[model samples]
Structures are given as C-alpha cells and as structure tokens.
Target: MEEKILTGRLYDVQGFSVQDGPGVRTTAFLKGCPLHCPWCHSPESQAFYKQLSWMSMRCLGVDACKQRCIKACPKNAIELGVTQKDVKTGTDLQLIHVKRDLCDNCGKCADACYVEALYLCGKDYTVDELVNRLLQDKKFYDRSGGGVTISGGEALSQLDFVIAVLKRLKNEGIHTALDTTGYAEWEKIAMTMPYVDLYLYDLKHLNSEKHQAVVGVPNEVILDNALKLAENGKKLQIRIPVIPMFNHDEKNIRDTAQFCKRLGNAVEVVQLLPYHNLGVMKYLRLSDDPVAEATLPNDAYIEKLKRIFEEYGLPVTVH
Candidate 1:
C-alpha cells in the first residue's frame, strides 16, 4: 500500500495495558460500535462522531476568562448558564452548557478553549501519522513483548482504517492485536486476519435471545465468526464480561465453557472480565445516562467462575 493519510476517529490511545493482550500494549480506542452493551467500560467510544466533553470543574467561569468558545460556536449552541441549584444547599454554580440538539460537533469550541476545559473526545489520524505515533514506543514494545492493540467502540466498525494501521505496524515488526466483539461481517474480520497476530474476541452471552435483548443484536453472527476464526487457524483469547444481572448464572457459565470446549484447541484462553462501573462517570462526560450501580463480583465469585472454565479443560484467567 502507498503511504498516505487514512483518517479515523479514536477516543483514546492508552499505553502499557497488560490485560489487553500478551504484553504491555498501546490500545488505540477507535470510536463506534454496533452493540450497546450496558456494561461497557468505554462509553465515549460508542458514537462514531466526535463528542464535546465539557468539564464543569475545570472551567474558569465567565467572570475569570474570555469566552472564546461561546463566540466561536457557529450554531450559538454554547451559552453561559447557572449550574442546577443544589437542592440541599440551594447554591447555584455558574457554568457553560452546550445545547446538544443544536451543536454540530464542529469542534470549534474545543479549539477556542484555552484552558482545555472543553475538549473533543475523538480525533482523526492518518495511517502514516498513527503509525509514527505508535512506533515511538518501539523500545517499550521490543522490551515487553508488547505492541499495538486496535480496540473500539468496535475496531472492525472502522475496518479499512484499522487494516491500514495494522498492516503498517506489521511491516515495522510490531505485533498487532484486534480487540473485537465479533459482531461485524466475517468477510471484514477475514480481511483483518493477515494483519492481526491475535484476536481479543468478546463473548457476551450464550443464549441468543438474552444477548439481543441486552446488546441490541443477535449472537449468532458473533458465535459463528468465533468458530470460523478458530477453524481458520486464527488465535483467539475469548473474553467474557461477567455481568451480575446478565450472564452470571451457573448454567450460562457452563454453557459458555462448553461452547469454548467445542472450539477445542483453536481456543487460546478464556478470560473472565468481571463487570465494573469504571466508565459510569464517562457516561456523564458524554451527556449520556449512567449505568445503574452494581456491586463488583467478589474475588471468590470470580474464582468460582474461573473454575467453571477450568472444569471444561479450557484455560481460564480472571481479569
């Protein structure tokens, strides 16, 4: 492929994440996903478009600073407003509010904010640009058996850009991993196989009906893709998020392990990712409803879930 710009939106680029793959990795979180998993840790990544993230506490307020963002907004969507009065103290704070309905997400406000109190969550990067950035950590990757991981909202949702980045990384001898939900078409996934060294595949639920009800899609395609990937000799480390209300039952656990067992030696490992409310605050940043509170599964419960996969003779790790 010729060297050129191949821009795609990404919410974050995290470094030294040991849990994502074999070693410390720089996980590029591409924006957008087909499924709306309630327990998602990276809620900001769901939308493919750039999001305006306003931090109220970081704001210097109208009195202390020039409101460049307010003037820069083409839609007049930004306005200075009193923060909602505290019911207990009856004290109202001053803040800037973005009328999301009118806001076009042009990111003009983000550029105008000198304090960076207002910022855009996603940014576009060219293939060459992103590769150069990832390659900066080459020494780290070489020493730690680490490389770059393409994660998402759903990495495959931006398939072309992902393949381009992965191909370049592979050329530079950097191991590449694709952390996907496996909800995308098989053809798209197959297109990424040559560039990807490992697949961090997520298995949400065993029952198709339950899966659709929660995640807004049928699991058949996801399951079929997993099996096919394994059959075609792709390395898979199946990741299962153990949500309390959603697939935590004994039967569900056993069924999942049995399914992995069916994949036989094609399965590399089964990672139990216990659900947490780590991204609940992130939802607030995106002006989305926060997930209802749920207690994280205790260590013993996680261990029990791990043992279930062990019973099936599949390698299991609780993360």
Candidate 2:
C-alpha cells in the first residue's frame, strides 16, 4: 500500500508572534475546538471545517465589482446584501451576502473578489508541508530562543496531526508550545507532552458551574488536566482572560492565585489576557452569532489583580 498523507486544517499560520510564546515564534491556529467560549479571540478556530467569510468593509459596491462573486459561485450561494435583520451599522451598501448553508466554501468567489471581500478561512496542509514552512524560520528561532506554537480550537482535537508536526519539530531540536483548552483524554495529553516543551494552559474559572454556564463546558476536566501536567513536571504558562461578568471578580482572581500556588514550581508564569473587542469583526465575518459585549479591563484594575498572584509567590504578567 502507498504511504498515506497526514494532513490537518489550520485557519492561519502567523509568523513572528511575540505574544504566543517566548521569543519570535510562528503560531499555527488550527481548526476545531471542543469549547464554545463566546469571547474567543480567533473566530475561525471554533469550527472543525473550512469556512467562507465576507468582509463587508472590503467589498466594493455590486456595480463596481460587476457582480463577479455571484458569477463565480456555481451554487448561487453568493447574493447581494444580507437580510435587514442581519445587517449591522458598518456598511451601507452591504454589497454581498453569503448563504452559508448553500455554500460549500469553494474558493471561486474568493478568487473573484480582488478586494478580498469574500475569502475562505481555513486551508489543509500535509504534515511535511507545515513542518517545512515552520522550519524556514529556524534561524530566527535559533537566535531568539523561539520555536513554533500550536494553538487551536484545542490543538489536541486533531491529535495525530499535532503529534506528527510537533514530534518532527522536536527531532529538529526546536522548542514547541501547546496552547490548549485542556478538554481532551489523558492519553492524548500523554502522547503530545513529550513533544511539547511548554504548555500554554487556559485557566478560565475555579468554579465548574460558572465555567460551564459561560463556555458550555465544566471546569473539572480542565482543572484536573492542569494539575496533572504540572505534576508531571511540565512548564506551564497559565492564561486567564479577564472578562467582565465572567471570571473577572477579585474572588476568582485570588482563587486562581491559590490554584497557581498549588501548581508550585511548575507554574512558570501566569498571563492575564484582558478582554478586547478584537474578535467582534471576525465573529461577524464567520457567523450571525451575537458577539458577546465585553470591554477591555482597565490596566490599573489588571495590575491590582496581578498583585494578588504575586502575593501568593507566583510570577504574573499582564498582556
């Protein structure tokens, strides 16, 4: 039998990202996540498949583009303007509409839209192809102590592909980080742990009920996984998204500090990611789902929270 090609779907591969991990790194945003956090940063990471997005801001009026998208789409999924109920205040023309159900995410329409008004969100990459692209930045990683970071709709969701690419990178002596939601089987974690040099762990809430209420999943498994990884001698970068009306209270902040203390020396660093509306536009492009209204936590307030963690003898940083 011929050797099989192992491929994975990723919405984006961002280069020179200082925000993802230490040094200059390439971050591959993979598709498919188990959790449904409304305030997720990458809108495309929610689904496990390819998506078609229409950037109303980029669209020229129908007359100017000469209806190229409509002509390109064989399924008639491209139309002119969304229904009044779906319209937002941004664009008056609302030049194109994507009938998502009818659309199969074909790139013909995206190709026709020279202004990038219509575009596909994800692309499939064979394991070797992805590794080669990442390795291109080896010089930068070498000088900066940076490597590749695999983030997802939960990276472990596509366990085999992630394992393949990370294992390859490890063999090449490059550092690797797994930015995960911690919603996977322990066996999956075990296999990938050896390949990952660092774990970017999401610690959303200490209370399971509140976690489930907001993210559609309880925190028990997530918390359990964190402890296990720490106990197993893995370095962890704990991330907390400070959002109003969810997991932003001082009580929760202090509780998180206590929890970090439990992780002991394995807790490498705690990153406080304040809420931002950066995902609003991306959300609108992906679906008709309501973008949960959130405001940026004030720097002063975030600093105050940082002190709580410091008091517990845990190093904390705000991003």
Candidate 3:
C-alpha cells in the first residue's frame, strides 16, 4: 500500500537565519496566524490561504505589459493607473493596479505576470520537499549548534503538518525549534511538544484587554500555555517585541519581566525584539494603501528595556 503524502502551506523558508534560533538555522516560515498585529512586518503571513500580491517595482505598467494581468483576471481585478506611490521611494508613479473587491485570489492574473509584478504569497510544500530544503544546511546546523526553527505566522495554526514536520526533523537528529505565538488550543500545541527541542515563544502584551486591542486575542490562553510548557519541562526562549506606545512602557516591561521570572528555569533566554519599520514596505505588496509607519525603537530604548529584564534576574538578549 502506498502512503499518502502530506502537504502544508508555507510563506517562505529562510536560509542561514541566525536570528530565528541558536546557531546557523534554516527557518521554515509556516503561513497563517491568529494575531492581526498592526506592527506585523510580514503582512503576507496572516492568511491561511494564498493571497495575491503586487510588486510595483517589478511591474512594467499597463502600457508595457499590455494589460496582461488586467486582461487575464477573470473578475476584471487589474486596471491601469488606479494610483501608485513608489514603494521604495514615496513619490507617485503610474503602475498597474489590482482591484481589491473584485479579486477572488484565483491567481490567474499571477500566472499571466511573467515579470512577477503580480504574485502569490503562499506555496504548498510537501513534508518531503520542506525537509529536503531544511536538510540542505544540515552541515551548518551541526557545526554551529543551529537547527531548523519552525516559525509562523503561528506554527500551531497548521498543527498536524507542523507535528509531522517536527517529528521528521527529530528523527533525523536535527535540533528542532518551534517558534510560535502560543495562540492555539492546548491539545493541538501539546502534540508538537514531544518533537520540539526548543520553543521560541512570543509574548506580545501582559494585559488581556490591551493585548486584544492590538493583536485580536487575549493573553490569558497564551500565558497559560507558556506556563504549561514550562511545567512540562520544555525549554523556552521567550521573545517579546518592544513595540513603541503599544507595550513598551515601564509597567508593561516590568510586568513582562516578572512573568518571565515566574516561568523560572525553563526559560533559557529572554530575547527582546525592538520594533522597526523594516517591514513597512512589504505592506505595499499586500494593500491598496500605504501603512502608517510606527516609531522605531532606538538602541538606547532597547537597551533600557533589556536592563529591565535583567532586573528580574532573567537572562536577556537583544536582537
């Protein structure tokens, strides 16, 4: 009897990623997240299904391309000269446009875009295919104390596929890291615990209401799951994004440090990811309008936050 192949949706597989986990790692960016964080640098990772994206710089305009996307779209989604502000430079220019309401993400227009001005955000990867891509850097992982880090939009969203991928990595003797928001049901997350070597758990905000206002979910379940993971003797590297005006105040930072303190020895490191506008340009690919850029955290501010974490006697690192 032939075994059926399992496939999962992926946003991207980033190679030689030192920031995702310890060592030189190949980070598998699984698609889909429960959180709708406004500060999200990767807008494309939010949806469960694939989404059409437009790269204005790559576009040759309606005249050059002969309205290929406009003509190919079954729903008449593409149009000439709707509006454009150069994504790289803020100046305006005429570029091909995608009609948001009419587009069903059918991807026929993307197929017609030879220049890749129109493209899809997510792709299907079989377990074998993804595993092969991860294994390409096995030598680097072995030598650098690095391994495969399964990061998401929230890896737990695709629980079954993640479990299968993690299990296979563990079988191959690769150090497996699960980077997650701790936003799924406990049972679904529990399935991956056995295979995960380390957890890169994300902590957004401490207050449930404040958390919900920004991220579309409460913090109670996420915090509870973290506690559960620690209780079960799982190693965790707590990742907190130091977003300005959102959760970077003294009280929140202190309270977060306090939470990490309570998590105790299960926590390996408290990594503070300072918020930046580095991903603001990506929003251009996913939206009709430009995203309002947030105030970026300075080095001094990030250092101050790190010192606060250290006040709780928690091991802290800034990246």
Candidate 4:
C-alpha cells in the first residue's frame, strides 16, 4: 500500500457509548455530512468546513473581560451587540456575534475567549492519531464485546480515512461498526464493507420525494446501496427516525417495515429512533434556524411502530 497520511475532521470521540453499536463502543463522530435531515441531533456535524459556534450561557460579556476577541479578529468579524436579554436576571448583556460573511474561520476569536464559550466545530486528525485515541479504551472493549463505531455527519463522506482507521482497528482484532446514511457511491461502500462488522444504516423514508424533501437527497441511492450490502452479506441495522408530521403516518410505518422485511436476515436490527428537539440548541449555537418543526412521537406511538415492524418478522427496538 502507498504510504498514506489521510486526515479526517472529527467533532467528538464519545467513550462507552452503548447506543451506537453492540456492547460499549467508543463512538468517533466525524464532522461533515451529506444529508440535511430535519431531525438531525448533531447539527454541528453537517458542514464540511470548520465553523465557529457561540454559546450565550458561557459568555461573560465585553465589560467583564474586555473585547479580546473583537480585537483579535483580523477580518473584524467579531462584534459586541445586545443579542438577547437575560430573562431570569432581567439584565441587558452584550454578546459576541460573528459576521459569517466576513469571517474566514481563523479561530482567533475562539482562542481569545477566556471562558471557551466560542469554539470551532471540527478538528483534523490523522488516521493513526485517531486510532490511538480510540485504542486507549481497549481495556473496556476487551472486557465487553465492544469496539469503535465510526459515526458521522456520515461515515462514508470520509471513506478513505474511515477505511484506513477501520483497517488498523481490524488489524488489532477490534470489532468495528459504521453508522452511516448510505448515500455515497457503491464502490466506496464496498471498499469499507470488509473492514466493518456492523452497518448502522439509516432508512429515513421509502418515498423518494418525501426523502428528498426532508433529507435533501433521494432515497433511491440509499435503498440501492442497502440492498447491495444485504446481498454482499454485510450485517445491517435499519435505523428509522420516527418524526411526527413526516413519516409517522400508519401507511409509512407499514411500508418501511415491509421494506425491511424484504431485506430478510441481513438486517439484524430495526431500531426506531424517535425524533427529539435536542438539536434545536445546536442550530442556535451555529446561528442557524432549525428546519424541523415536528415534535417527538409519544411513547405509545413509538411502541405501536415497533409492533408494526415486529409483525413483519423483523427484530425491532425503540430508542
């Protein structure tokens, strides 16, 4: 193999994550996604470029520490303004806002922040460096059946680096999993399949138009890739996010279950991931508006959906 030094933009490395995969996996969240799911919990991971995020709660205002960031910004992107009024204290506080058009994401403002309220969303890490970071939790993986889960914005978006890291992990006998949207080219999927033990595949909608409307991509490619994976004997888990006013109708639920049923034993799990508004704050942090107006499905409704999948002889779980 040619000597490679591929680096991937990472947002987080959450250890002991039982939700992402089997056992206690260390989920490495990669930045940059191809999809724009309205119910995306990790809004920070959507962009391919580095982004500055400001949390108003941690800001001490210009009066407390002076305008270090405003002065440090070379492009004059940082400024002090009365962004909001503190409702509990009834105090008018000046907050730092980034003029996104003028800002070049230099991180000077983030560096100048004493309280670290403002920071960059993505960090670059070489394949070896990331694998080493994840390997630190090898003891936990040895004890449990867990390993590392390469999650994203979408794992396949960074296919080469992901494959490189997965190959290294596999070399160490680590059980690897990939949490993806399955929107990438078929060749890239095939390249990573052998290294990955499990595929936490997302199946948002069966209808192409509805999928494109909500996720900003047609489901044809996703469905085709999924069938290929199943045919290739790669393990799969079809993850469905139960969003209200979107795919919560009875017809949609049955249709999805029937589709998963066709995949047969290739799909080891059909996980119903109910929608939540947890990402609303993340959108605010990035100074962007949320696309999802739908509320989360109730417990009873979630259970009903689970039963529908189970009726198709498919193993189902709600999260």
Worst 10-residue lDDT window for candidate 1 reads 84-93
Q: For candidate 1, lDDT tens digit of each residue in 56-168?
A: 76776655567788989999998987665445556664678888888888899989888888899998988888888898888889999999999998989888899999989
Q: Once superposed on the true structure, which residue ranges of model 2 sit more than 4 Å away at CA?
A: 82-94
Ranking by TM-score: 4, 3, 2, 1
lDDT of 2 by residue, 197-272 (tens): 9999998999999999889889888888889998899999999999988999999999999998999888889999
lDDT of 3: 0.89
Better of 1 and 2 by lDDT: 2
- Clash count per candidate: 0, 1, 0, 0
Candidate 1 Cα deviation (angstroms), residue 66: 3.0
Query: Which 10-residue span in candidate 2 carries the lowest summed lDDT?
Result: 83-92
C-alpha TM-score for every candidate: 0.92, 0.93, 0.93, 0.94
Task: Report how far off residue 43 is in candidate 4 (Å).
Answer: 1.1
RMSD of each: 3.3, 3.4, 2.8, 2.3
Q: Which has the higher TM-score value, candidate number 2 or candidate number 3?
A: 3
